[model samples]
Target: MRFSATALLALPLLAAAAESPYEQYKAKFQSFLSNFGVAGPAADKASAPATPSISTGKAKKKVTEPKPIHTLTLDNWKDTLYAPVKAEATQPEEWLVLVSGRNKTCYSHCLRIEAAFNESATKFAAMPQSPSLGYVNCDDQPVLCNSWSAGTGNLWIFEMLPAPAPVDIHYKRLNLTTVTSQDIVDAYTGRPDIQWRKFEGYFHPIDGFFAKYGLSVPLGYFFWALGAIPSWAMMLVVSFMTRTMMNRRMGDANRQGNAGGGAAPRAAPPGDGRS
Candidate 1:
């Protein structure tokens, strides 16, 4: 086909218009801009600056802190209980303390008491006013027990106050020998001048072990026997194995000696015997 230079240039532009969407749009936009007497690039730049910026001014929420729970210990006993009572001489807040033996020795009862008192304390603390609840180790703090008329491995209630003297403490023993967590809560919340009966004889060692775990006497003995059986069986098996190994070694030694003795003695030298 024959074509002029201008026509060939027009052919490339037509091909671009057909193949590229951007070029086609630009050509149409430039036509509209020429009709309106506006430059395409400058108009786009001027329109960009006309868009408005937005501000929300959103703020983050603040979190509230929780209240702390208090439990009595040897270190804090003086500061939380004794010091307060001593400082406030005539009028002092009521304090509940459970005195028991060393944790290792009386862990079961001590743990039960502690858990109960902790629950009671949490409940009481929610009220308008609540007395302090605490635990004391009799072994660690024998003097405190004596001063408060508390015996080791037993729960004691005391009313403490600051007097003209060093301290004024009154003991209030409960009537019941065995007390639960609820019992303590009731006693603390209820009457202070309640009558108390003397505790009977202490429990026997075996009886106490079973009682502490809330097991019947027969059941406790059965479990004890059950625990002992495995140890006894293991000891018997070890003894039998040792005896068997020893007997096997002795038999082997005897067999070797007998075999050596039964063998014929070496013959005398042939030349010496002939002479």
Candidate 2:
């Protein structure tokens, strides 16, 4: 009878544990997968069309594609910036500008702008900056910024300068600096030396974040967070100090003015009033 009672009491505790938050999360994730038409837990082990099965006479198993992952680096910096050139009378063409911080291991990939290209007499320009896309236009140039995800990476391509009235743009990559202005003119009938400029942008330092947790966060996140600190704090501090100094100076000036005998005594202001 004692054993039976203890067993019955333990059953309720086990049931409570089974209904924990972790189990709830598992249930919710399963439902999410179910909505996508997969057979919950057995989706990986089942012989379904989406899950490819391989058999070697002795055993059969389902195969799943590997998941893609982004690398977290402390020293790598892949940030980039772009600045486009404005048109001038002497230089009547636009140029694409690019500045990128290099990564120690990974090469910066798919670095390009997305803009319109056509035959025109005036210079047209489009630029892209890290965290934003910037552009400069001399004439009423048409430019587009399109970023499409191609598989695991992004695709960015655009035009810098429009071609002459007779010629049209055939390729998207504008390698004008490498080629002479006359070459560009010959390639597109009267277009001048419209080139793409590139430079280095701000890069996040590696191992900068580990200091936050006492475990030493990566430098990249640390520098990034430090850079994002509010500028208003510094401005407010400086303004406060300035105001304090100005007040002290004004107080000293007031003391000096009082000591300088600037105020005359009301001598006999009104002998006529009351002696």
Candidate 3:
């Protein structure tokens, strides 16, 4: 039969020759659905949760703070203990701070003592560690001084006047009649080390010129002397001494002529008086 192009195309699709058109159409529809994933229920239920439920055996932990340590003192503070703290000032109201051990720090302790140790006119003596590692200010009302170290522990004793010679303040053997450990700790409204005892009897602060040699005094002297000499004057003195030493070693016999001494006296002219 005579067929137009459209009629021929539609006739074959509708008639189906070697294979069934319906079956081909079904296969193609399934393929398209699979490519886009619209064909079946979503892949297995989103994988089961790795852990269905958490265990309840573990519990939260609590934190604990460190306990304060005991305060150690020297048995014979005046003799056994030797340090720069003795050079500190002495006053009934003044306080002394002692810190030791490499990791030990007395900043807070010193501040608290300063509040109780000072009077309206009290003053703080210069400490060896001052102007560098640390310093004290009696005028600050709450004067704070501290010692930090990683090697040997330092004993610091605060008094109303500067420390005595040999420069050591031992708290252990104070005449336990006046200032006891409890007295001091109690005054500060805190509990210090357990070995507190009241020092009784006459406790006089020692004084002597040797006390001047304490850390602060000598340090000051060194700096003062260092500043007194002018650069040129120091250079001249050093040069002169060096030359003197060198001349003595080299045995410069001619150097005497160049020096201020006059030339050897000429032999008296043969008896001028004879003429």
- For model 2, the stretches where C-alpha displacement exceeds 4 angstroms are 1-192, 198-227, 231-235, 262-275
Candidate number with the higher lDDT (1 or 2):
1
How far residue 30's Cα lies from its native spot in candidate 3, in Å, is 85
Looking at model 3, residue 166 earns an lDDT score of 26
Lowest summed lDDT window (length 10), candidate 3? 142-151
Off by over 4 Å in 1: 1-82, 85-90, 103-107, 146-149, 152-157, 165-180, 193-275
When superposed on Cα atoms, how far off is each prediction in RMSD? 25.8, 28.6, 20.9
Candidate 3 lDDT over 27-130, as tens digits, reads: 88788889986874433667644656877988876533212122323222333223333445342222344332211233333443323232211212222221
Cα distance off (Å), candidate 3, residue 247: 1.2
Q: Which tens-of-lDDT digit does each residue in 40-148 have in candidate 2? A: 7654646655756767677555443322111212222112211232232232222222212122111333122111112111122111211122222211111110001
Cα lDDT, all candidates: 0.55, 0.34, 0.37
Model 2: residue 123 alpha-carbon error in angstroms: 27
Per-residue alpha-carbon lDDT of candidate 1 for residues 1-275, written as tens digits (9 for 90 to 100): 88899998798789877879977787899989989888677545656766576768876765433223334443465466655465545655666666665553354456555555556665665557656666777556543443333554444443455533333233344333465667666766665445433322222211233334544344534543454467779799889999999999999999999989988999976575554
In model 3, the runs with Cα more than 4 Å from the true position are: 1-93, 96-157, 161-209, 212-223, 230-232, 252-275
Q: Kindly report the root-mean-square deviation of model 3 from the true structure over all alpha carbons.
A: 20.9
Error of 1 at 149 (Å): 4.5
The number of clashing residue pairs in each candidate reads 1, 16, 26
